[model samples]
Target chain A: MAESVSEVRAWVNQRRGEGRTIGLVPTMGFLHDGHLSLVKRAKAAGHAVVMSIFVNPLQFGPGEDYDRYPRDIARDRKLAERTGVDLLFTPSVEEMYPRALQVTLRVGDLANRLCGLSRPGHFDGVATVVAKLFHIVEPDEAFFGEKDYQQLRIIQTMVEDLNLPVKVIGCPTVREADGLAMSSRNRYLSPEERRRAAVLSRALFDAARRCREGTTRAAELVQSVTQQLSSAGLEVEYVSAVREEDLGQVDQIDQPCRLLAAVRVGETRLIDNVALEAGKGMGHVSAYVDR
Target chain B: MAESVSEVRAWVNQRRGEGRTIGLVPTMGFLHDGHLSLVKRAKAAGHAVVMSIFVNPLQFGPGEDYDRYPRDIARDRKLAERTGVDLLFTPSVEEMYPRALQVTLRVGDLANRLCGLSRPGHFDGVATVVAKLFHIVEPDEAFFGEKDYQQLRIIQTMVEDLNLPVKVIGCPTVREADGLAMSSRNRYLSPEERRRAAVLSRALFDAARRCREGTTRAAELVQSVTQQLSSAGLEVEYVSAVREEDLGQVDQIDQPCRLLAAVRVGETRLIDNVALEAGKGMGHVSAYVDR
Candidate 1:
C-alpha cells in the first residue's frame, strides 16, 4: 500500500528502532526520469525509500507560477512504485500548512545572492518547507539534485547547521540530449521557447570552453555569455562565474568554477550551470585544483 | 540503553509502525515539577514520551538573558529517567544549528501582542525552534503549557496553518502558592525581587476583580495595575486588557478578555495574565484559561 505521511513515518520509526536505514527523495510531483534517478539512488544506498510529493507554496512568490506548478499524484505514485519507492506521502496543502506560520529560517549572506536575489523569499521558502519535510520524512539520508545548485547548497547548509541527523546527498543534475536541464517548469515554455532555451546550456558550455582555454577573468566570461544569451533573444537575469563549492563570486577563475546563468525565454525563466576547470576540457579535471 | 537523536528517532518509528502512540514534550533543560506534570499527562494519555531538552539561543534576544538561561544536563537526565521518558534529545548548539538559517515562520498579528511586543523576535525564535523540534521529534501529539498563553496561541496557529500532523495539547499553567506563574525564568528573580514579582499576578487579579465588579473601562483597569506595579518597585512595561482569542485592544469588557502585563522586577522580566469574565469573579478559575 502507498502509505500516508503518518503511516510511513510510523513504519520508518519501527524499522529505525530495529536498526534499519531509511532514505528520502523530495519531489514536487509530476515525477519524471530525474526524480526516478534520485529514487533509484536512494534505494541503492540501502534502506526503504520515501518520496514526498508537495508543491510547497512557501517556496513560491505571489505572481510566480505557484498556482500553475504541475502536480500529478496519481502519476507520481505509479512512477514511485515502479522505482521501488516504499512509501509515497502526497499530502494536501491544508495537510502541510494548517495555520499561519510565525517562525522562519534565514541563512544570511548566501541566500541574498544568486537565484535568491531574483526570487526574493524563494530560498527561505525552500529552506523552511524542506526543514518541515525533513521532520515529517525523518529519512536517514535525503537526496537532492545539483541541477538546482543554490537550492542544493541551501539545504545542505540547513541540515548541517540544524544538526539534523539526516545526511544530505547531492546527485548529479540530469539533463536532456539537447542539454536542457529537466524541470517541471520546462512545460511552461512554448515550443519555440523550449528550443531556444537550450541556448542557456550552450552559453554555459561556451563559457566553460573559454575557461579551459586559459581565459580567467570571471567578469569577461560572464559578459561573453550575457551577450550570447541576449543575441539569442533571451532576457538574461544574471550571468556569473562562481566558485564551485561555496557559490561565491570570483574575479579570476584560478580553480574549478561554476558558470551559471538565469534567463527568460519568452515568459518562462530558466536556469542552468556547468563546472569548468582551467587547462582541462571537461574530462581531465582534478578535484581542488586551486590548492 | 540511552539513545542519540537518530537512535531515539528510530525507536519511535518502530513503535509507531507497531501502531503505538508517541508524544513529545519540548523544554529547555531545567526540568522542574511543572515539566514533569506535562510528562505525566503525556504518559497518562497513552503516549511514549520523548522529551527534548534544548535551550534554544534564537528565541533569546541579544543581552536578553540567552547566556544566563539556566542549564543542568546531569540533573535533567536524571529527571527524564524518573519521569519514564522513553527518549531524551539534548543536541549541542552546533548540532541544532550547523549552518545559518534563511527562512522564518511568522504568525502575523498574533505575534505582535503582549510578550511579543516586549521581546520583539522572541516568539519567532520560539516558533522556529519549536517547529524545528516538531520536525525532528515527529510526535503524534506535542504538549505545551497555557502558562505562556500567547506562545501557546501562536504555536497553535503555526501548527494549524502549516498542516503539521502533530496534535497540539495545551496543558493548564502550573503556579506557585502565592499565585505567581511557574517558569524556568522565575529562578532568575532575587529573593526580594521574587516576592515583589508576585505583584504581577496580584495586579492581574486586581484587574480581573475590577472587571468582574462592573468596571468595563479597560483603560481604567490598565491604569490601576500600572500604578500598583510601579508602587511595588517594578518598572511596568505594558498593561492592557484585550480579547482573549484575537488579542485586540478593547475599551469595554463585554466579551472574553485577558488581563496581561509584563514588568521588569530589577533585571528579570516577568509576564502574567488572568482571564476575566464579564460579570463573574475570574470565573471557572483555570490556571491557564483561554477566552
Candidate 2:
C-alpha cells in the first residue's frame, strides 16, 4: 500500500515493538541505477527497506545548483516500488524542516578539508539532515554509496562519535561505462560536457598511475592532475591526494592514499577518486575504492 | 528482562521490526518524585518508557558546577527498576560523547532571552544534547517538566522544526510546599539560602497580585518585585513580566502574563514564576491575594 512518512514511521514502530529489523536507504528523488542498488542491498539484508527522497537544502551551497538539481517524483516512486522498497518517505521541504533548523551537526577538522573546504557547510548540512533522518527512520542499518567518499567517512565518524544505533554499510561506487561515476548530477551535463567529464575519472587514474610509478609526493600528483584536467578543457576546482580513511592532507604516500578530484565541465561539476597503497618502491591502485 | 543500553536498543529494534510504540523520558540520575511523575505519565499514556541518565556536560557553563553535580548510580538503578522503565540508558559522558561536541543547537531569539540571558550557552547545550539523545532514543513521545519552562519550549520547537519522530509532552512543574521550584541545583544551597529561596515564589506571587490589582503596566509589577527581593538582601538577577506562552516581553497585561524571577542568595541561585491574566483588573486579586 502507498504510505506517507508518518504512516511508514508508525509501521516501523509497530514492527520494532514486535522485534523486527528495519533497513533504510536515503536518496534524492531522482531514482537511478545507483539508488536501486542500495534498495536491493537493503531488502536482501532481510530488512523492511525504507527509502527517503528529500533534497536536503542544507547540503546545497548558495550559488550552487540546488534549484537545478534533477528531480522526478513520479518516476522515483515507480522505481522504488519496482525495487521492493517497503516504504517511501517523500516529505516536503516544509515537512522535513517545519521551522528554521537551529541545531547544526558538524564534524570539526574532518569537515574542514576536501569537499567540505570547497563547498563550505556542505557536510554540516549532510551530517545534520542525515542525523535527523536517522532519528526519524530509526533503522538497524543504513546504506550509503562509496561514490561520496568524504560523506561516507564523515557519517562513520558522526555515528561512532555520537553512538547512533544504525549500522552504516558503505556500498561500492556505482559507475557508468567510460568510467564515469553515476550520480543524479550526471544528467545535467550536455553531451559534449559529458564527454569532457570523463576526465575526472581519467585524471584520478593518471594520478594513481603516477603514484604507482614512484611519484610519492602529494603536491606533485595534485599538480599533474590539475594540468591534465585543465588540458582537457575542464575547470578544475581541486585535485589533491589525502589519507584514505580520514581525508586529511598527506605529505607523502606513507600509507594508503585517496587521489580525489572535482572539476567543472561547462556548468556541471563532477567528482571521482581512486585509492593507492604504497608498496616496495611502487604503489598499487584500486579503482573506485570505498573510504 | 534486565538489559544494558546496547541490548535494550537491539531489543527495541527487534520490536520495531515486528511493529510497536516506544516512549522516552530523559532524566539525569538521582531520579526524584518529580521524575517518577513523568515516568508514570509515560506509562499511563501506553508508552514503553526508555529513561536515560547522563549528566550532560555540554549544558554546564564553565565554572558553573558540573563536577560537583550530584550522582548516585546505585540509587538511580534502584529507582529505574522501581519506576518500571522498559530500558534505562545510563551512558557515561565518554559513551554518549566520545569526541568533542562542536555542533550546537541554538533556538535563535528564544535562547537569548530570559534564563538564556543569565545562563549563556546553557540552552544551546540542552538543545544539542537533547537532539543527540532524541536520535539515540528514537522514542514515540518524550516527556519533560514545565518546571524548566524555557527548556520545555525549546524542545517542543526543536521537535516541530526538525520533524523528529518523537512527540514532546510537557508535564506541570512539581514543586515544594513553600513553593520553590524543584531542581537538582537546590541541593547546592545552604540551609538558610534554601529557606530564603522560597522568596522567589513569594515575589512572583506578589507581582501576580499587583497585575490583578489593576496594575496593567508590566514594568511596574517587575519594579515592585525587584525592590521586594532587593530589600530581602538577595542579589536579583532579573525579574520580568512577559507573555505566558512565548516568553516575549509585553508592554501591557492584556494577555496571560508570566511573572518570572531569578535571584542569588549566598552562593545559590533560584528561579520561579506565576501566571496571571494581566487585563483582569481588581476582580482577579481575590483569586491570588493571600499565599
Candidate 3:
C-alpha cells in the first residue's frame, strides 16, 4: 500500500522498467463486490493492477456525501491484496490536491444528462480526478463498472476526446443475490431500505426483458421502470433511456440502449442500469435476479 | 516531417525503448528564430527533440487570425531538419480532432486576466490543445517562450494541478535585431508599424530599469510603461506589473515581478514582458535594447 504520490510513482516507474502493462481501478473505499470485480478484471487484462481508493471531494456537492462517504482502508487493502492488485494507492486529500485544482474538465451536453441532471458538476469532478489518477498511474488500460452507466460513458468520451493513452474497459455491474446492485452507499441503507432497494435492479431487468419482447419505444421502457419504482414507494428521480454508445437520446431504440434509473428508497439514493438490445435480454440478469 | 499522429507516436515509442529522454517544442508554422531557439534548447536538455508545427484552431476566436494565420510548410520542414530536431510532427487539424472535441479544459482565474481578459475562452482552448499535444507526445520536458508570460504560468499551473508528467520549461523571449519580439503575426505589420513596434520591447526594458533604480512601486512602473507606449502612436491595451510566479497583483515590488503590456501597432496585436528583481535591470535587456 502506497500513501504518497511520489512513492506510487516510483513503484510505477519500476514496474514500467520491467515492461509490465498496468491497469487502474479507481474507487471510493468500503470494499463492495462491484469494486472488487473491477480489480479482478484489471488483473486479468493487465500484468499489473493498481487500485486507487479515494473519496474524491471534487465529485461531491455541497450537501452531498463527501463528509460521510464510507472509508475503510484496512478492509479495502485486504480485498485488493486478495484480488491480486499489485499496488493499493490511498493518498491523502491534501496530497492529491496540495492547492485547489483550478483546471476544469467538462464533457459538454453528455455531462448534462442522466445523473448529471440532479448532480450538477458531479461528472466534471469525476472526470478531473479520474484524469489525475490516469496520469499518476500511467496505466495502459482502466476498468470501470457498468453500474454507473453515465459515469462509464463520460469517462469513455473524455479518454477519446483527450486522446489519453489508456483504454477504458467497462466491466459488468456486480450485484447481490437479492437483486440489489452492489454499492458502497448500500451500507447506508437500513434493513428495510435494503430490502426495498432490490426493486431498483429488478425494475431494470424487467425493463430490459420487455425491450427484448419488442417494446422498443424508449418512452415506454422509461414509463415501465418509473412505475415499478413508484409502486415500491421509491421516489424516482429519473428513468432515462439513452443510446449506449454516446448517451445520446433515443426515441425509438433500434440498436443497443441503456435503461437507467436513480431512486430514493427511504433516505438512501440507489441507481441501477441494464443494456437493452431488441433481441438481447439483460446480458447478465440471471446473476442478480432469480428469474 | 511525420504527418500523422500514429507515425509520430510510433517514433516516440522506438526512442523510449532505447532509453532516450524526449523534449517537445510546440509551434504554429512560419519558422522564426523564436521557435528555432526553443528547438535548440530542447535538444540540449533531452536526448531527443520533437517539434510539432500545428496552428491549433481551438485557440482562435471567431474574428481572430485563424483563417489568415501564416503557413509555410516547405520552409518549416527545412528549418526543423537544419536545427537537428529528431522528429517533426505536422498533423492536420482533422487528424488531431477527428470529431468535435467536447472535453473543455479551463484554468479558471488564471485564465481570466491579461490576454485572457481580451480574448475570452482563448486560454481554455490553448489549455485543451496543449494537453492533447502533451498526451500525444509524452515528452519529458515541454518548451515555451516567456514572451507569453501569462500563457506560460497558466500551462505550468495546469500541469501541476493535473499532475501531468511533463516538465514545462520557460526560455527567455527571443527578440528581433531592433528589439521587436518575434511573432508569427509580425508578418502582418506594415513597414511603419514594423518600425514602431520596437517601442513595446523598449517600454518593458525602461520600466525594469526604473524598478532596479529603487522605483519599486508597481503603479509607478505601470504608468511609465503605459506612457511610453501611448507616446509611440500605439494603442495601449493593458500594462500591469504582477508577481512573476502567479501573476498576482504586485502593489510593492519588493520581490521579482513581471511588467507585461499588450498593444496594437496599426492592425497587429503585439505583446511583450520582462522580469524585474529590485536590482536586476531586465536580466536579458542587453539583447533586446540598446543599454
Candidate 4:
C-alpha cells in the first residue's frame, strides 16, 4: 500500500518497465463487495490491478458529507489485499489536492440530469478527479461500477472527447441479499431505514420489468416508480427513464434505456438504476422484493 | 504528415517501440519563424518532434476572426518538413471534434485575469484542446512559446493539476527584427499598422526596464506603458504588471513579475510581454525601432 504520489509512480514505473499492463479501480473507501468485484474483473483482464481509495472532497457539495464520508483504512486495506490487488493507494486530501483546486473538468447536459439535477456540480467534481487519477496512474484500463450509471457514462464521454488512451470498463452493479444496491452510504441508515432502503432498488427493478413488458410511456413508468417509493416511506427525488447513450429523458421506449431512481429514506439518500431493453422478455432486472 | 488521429498514433507507437522519446509542438498554422524555433528546441531535446496545426473553433468566440485565421497547408508542410518535424498533424475541425464539444477543461482564476478578462471562455477552449492534444500525442515534452505568457502559465498549471506526464517547456518569445512579436495575426496588419505594432513590444520593454530600475509601483509602470502605446497610435487594451506564476496582478513590483500589454493597431490586435527582474540590467528587449 502506498499513500504518496511519488511512491505510486515509482511502483507503476517499475511495472511498466517490465511491460506489464496496469488496471485501476478508483473508489471512495468503506470497501463494499461492489468495489471488490471491480477489482476481480480488472484482474481477470490480465492486468496488474491497482485500487485507489480516495473519499474525494471535491465530489461533495456544500452541506454534503465531505467531512464525514465513511473511511476505515485498516478495514479497507485488508479487503483490498484479500481481493488480490497488487497495490492499494490511499491518499489524503492534501496529497491529492496540494493547493486549492481551481481547475475543473466538466461534461455538458449529461451532468444536468437525474442525480445531477439535485446535486449540482457533483459530476464536475467526479470528472475532474478521475481525469487527474487517469493521468497519474496511466492505467491501460480502468474499471468502474455501473451502479453509478450516470458517472460511468460521463467518464466514457470524457475519455472519448479527450482521446485518453485508457479504456473504461463498467461492471454490473453489486447488490445486497435484500435487493438493495451495495453502497458505503448504506452504513448511515438506521436499522429500520436500511430495510426500507431496499425499496429504492426494488422500484427500479420493478419499473425495468414493466418497461421490458411494453410499458413504453415515460410518464407512466416514472409516476409508478415515484408512487412505489413514496408508499415505501421514502421521499422520491426523481424517477427518470433516460436514454442510455446521451442520458436524455426518452418520451417513449423505442430503444435501450435506463430506469433510474433516487430516494431519501430518512436522511440518507440512495439511488439505483436498471437497464431496460425495448419490448417483452429481453431485459434483465435484479431480483425484486415481493409485496 | 498525418491528417488523422489513427495514423498519428501508429507513427507515435512505432517511434516508442524503438524507445525514442517524443516531443510535441501544437500550433494554429501559417507557420512563422517562432514555430520553427520551437521545433529546433524540441529537436535539441533529442526527441522525435511532432507538430499539430489546428485552428480550433472552440478557442474563438463569435466574431473573433476564426474564419479569417491564417492557414496555408502547402506552405506550412514545407516549413515543418524543413525543420525536421517527424510528423505534422493538421486535423480538420470535423476530425478534431467529431461531435459537438460537450466537455471542457478549465483553469479558474489563472485564466480569468489579463487576456482572459477581455476574452471570456478563450482560455477554457485552449485548455480543452491542448488537453486533448496532450492525450493524443502522449509526448514526453511539449513546447510552447512564452509569447503567450498567460497561456503558457495556464497550460503549466493545468498539467501540474491534472498530473499529466508530459513536461511543458516554455521557450522565450520569438520576435522579428523590428521588435514586433511573431504572430499569425500580425499578417492582418496594414503596412503602417505593422510598423505601429512594434510599439506593443517596445512599451513592454520600457516597462520592464523601469521595473529593473526600481520603479516598484504597478500603477506608475502601467501608466508609462499605456501612455507610450497611446502616443504610438495604438489603442491600449490593458497594461498590467502581474506575478509570474499565478498571473495575479501585482500592486507593487516586490517580486519577479511580468509586464504584459495588449494593443490594437488599426483592426489588428497584438500582445507582448517581458519578464521583469527587480534590479539593474541583463534584460533582452525585442527592438528599439530606432526612429
Candidate maximizing DockQ = 3
Compare the candidates by lDDT and give the number of the best one: 4
- The list of candidate 3 runs beyond 4 A from truth reads A281-291, B281-291
TM-score of each: 0.80, 0.86, 0.97, 0.97
After superposition on all CA atoms, how large is the RMSD of candidate 3? 2.0
iRMSD, model 1, in Å: 3.7
Chain B TM, every candidate:
0.92, 0.88, 0.96, 0.96
Off by over 4 Å in 2: A1-4, A11-20, A210-216, A280-291, B1-4, B7-23, B30-32, B43-50, B74-89, B102-106, B209-216, B242-245, B253-257, B278-291
Minimum summed lDDT over a 10-residue window in model 1 chain A is located at A282-291
Regarding TM-score, does 2 or 3 come out ahead?
A: 3
List TM-score (chain A only) for every prediction.
0.93, 0.91, 0.96, 0.96
Per-residue lDDT over B1-291 for candidate 3, one digit per residue giving the tens place of the 0 to 100 score: 698878988999999989899999999889888889899899888559999999998899889899999999999999999998889999999988898876778788888788888999899988998998898999999999888889999999989999899999998888887778889999999998999999998888888788877889899899988988999999998999888777888899887788899999987899999887686644555325221
Supply DockQ values for each candidate: 0.29, 0.40, 0.82, 0.76
Provide the lowest-lDDT 10-residue window in model 3 chain B: B282-291
Provide the lDDT at B54 for model 1.
87
